[model samples]
Target: MLRSSNPLEPTTASFGATDIPRKPNYDFERREREKTKAAESAKKAQAKAEKRAAEKGASDADQSGGS
Candidate 1:
């Protein structure tokens, strides 16, 4: 019973089916959780690597300075 004059606007006949909204897949939540977990793991690995490298650089500098 919509009174819109434009054809582009949704009318009463289609019942909003023509809008074509995306429906999420059944595994979407699981997939998203896995993706988040992977991202967090990668971030932690990168941080650990950076910390190790900084420690190694500091130790090397100290050894070279003492000589």
Candidate 2:
């Protein structure tokens, strides 16, 4: 019987060959990141708008009370 020097090489003929793992999908990962980023941006924008509206309302009330 012949023996392979490399440890990675399968020794026995009866044993099935090992399948290599699939490579990472960079495009899919990038798209997912972009989606999360867009969602966060939208959320921040909404909060900012709400804060601006509240400040505007407060100022208007203050002006009316002062007059």
Top candidate by TM-score: 2
Candidate 2, residue 34: the lDDT equals: 100
Best by lDDT: 2
Residue range 1-67, candidate 2, lDDT tens digits: 7589998888899687678898999999999999999999999999999999999999999999999
Per-residue lDDT over 1-67 for candidate 1, one digit per residue giving the tens place of the 0 to 100 score: 5788898876777674665778978698889999999999999999999999999999999999999
Against the true structure, what is every candidate's RMSD? 6.0, 10.2
Q: How close is candidate 2 to the true structure, as a TM-score?
A: 0.65
CA lDDT of 15 in candidate 1?
72
Backbone clashes, each candidate = 0, 0
